[model samples]
Target: MSPVEPSTAKGAATRARLLDVAARVFAEKGYGAAKFSELISESGLTKGAFYFYFPSKAALARAVIDDQERRWVAEVQQRVLAQATPTQQLADVMPAMLELLAREPGAWSVVRLVRELGADAGLADDVVKPMDAWIALVAGIIRDGQQAREFRADLDADGLATVLVGAFDGIKGLVDSTSPEDREQRLTRYTGILGDMAFAELGILAHPRDL
Candidate 1:
């Protein structure tokens, strides 16, 4: 987790500014290339101001991931939850996230950071595992559906959720090497195939949603 968030308004604004600059920098140059000197200069904050919120690059990186994850859980997941049935709610996960990615630059950085930092970083205790949180969320939704007789009773909700989340995240990586136009086509194809197969097998739907 990040150091305690600022309790003061001015401190909060400064921290947010740093995050905005850092997110872009990290996105352009992966974590290994990002430096505090560049981040502080880009944010127009003094060294002391930057250190006040983040003691190291690793800390700031964790904050970035946590911030983006919180937004997805709040903005994307909550919007999907508004759907009438658990089936609809589960089905909306991919499209809802795609919408966020379309507008949020920070989200793309989080994806790169998750793959990079998780590979090394060696700060397992400090870094928040957003993937784990996602799995728990999906599994909870699956359990609710199962209990309501809306999802298959024979399937293990946790395992099923793990597979869905794993495939969903991995499928996004498949687009990184494609041309911008082809990226959307491939994502839609992969996501639709995954969602359709999973939804049908779970008895959620026989046909795809508008996604």
Candidate 2:
């Protein structure tokens, strides 16, 4: 069953608190390892109160995933794209996402939880939908760039978008495994390289400053 939506302000606060606590708990300890008691304790909510909002741990996990996707699309994807040219928007994608993940514990937790669940849990598709949206957004930008002669007309925007998304995801995985201090530097270098590769493929002359 779906989670209960609280109508009152206090109820809404309580629900949000539960989600925040659950996200941290699940992220720290994988969904299977995370206990209901830990979530309740961290949330500072009683068991009865917790059950009022979330029927089960699985339900809470799903809620966290859904919320993460919404925030990512609204706050990250749409927000960044709104103020930049298509090429600049594409260039900003990875850096913006990496920054968001670094700053937002809940966002980072959602990514960790989704990775832990993998494809066997039947949650992969849901978790990956936001990424699919990102791909579409990037494709649109690439198409715009092509029309403006900022990118190569011979290249397929959709195909290049897929490759870029795959490259970012792969690099992110590697960066996530490194020390926190090194992650930013590693990501910056890796993404810069990817951007250079994209620019080269598109026959665009990238300024050294662009990297």
Clashing pairs in 1: none
Clashes of each: 0, 0
**Model 2 over residues 1-211: C-alpha lDDT tens digits?**
6789999999998887788778777766667788877887788777888889997877788788777767776676776577456677777777677777777776656656666655545766666665777688778888988888788888888888999987887776666655667666788788888878887787778642263
Q: Which structure among the candidates has the greatest lDDT?
A: 1
lDDT of 1 by residue, 1-211 (tens): 3555899998888888788788888877778888778887898878887787887888888888888887787787788788887777888888888878777776677767776787775865544467778888788888888988989999889999999988888877656534557666678788889988888778865564753
TM-score, one value per model: 0.89, 0.83
lDDT of 2: 0.75
Reference-based TM-score, model 2:
0.83
Cα-based lDDT for every prediction: 0.79, 0.75
Query: How far out, in Å, is residue 205 in model 1?
Result: 4.3
Q: CA shift at 131, candidate 2, in angstroms? A: 1.8
In candidate 2, how many clashes are counted?
0
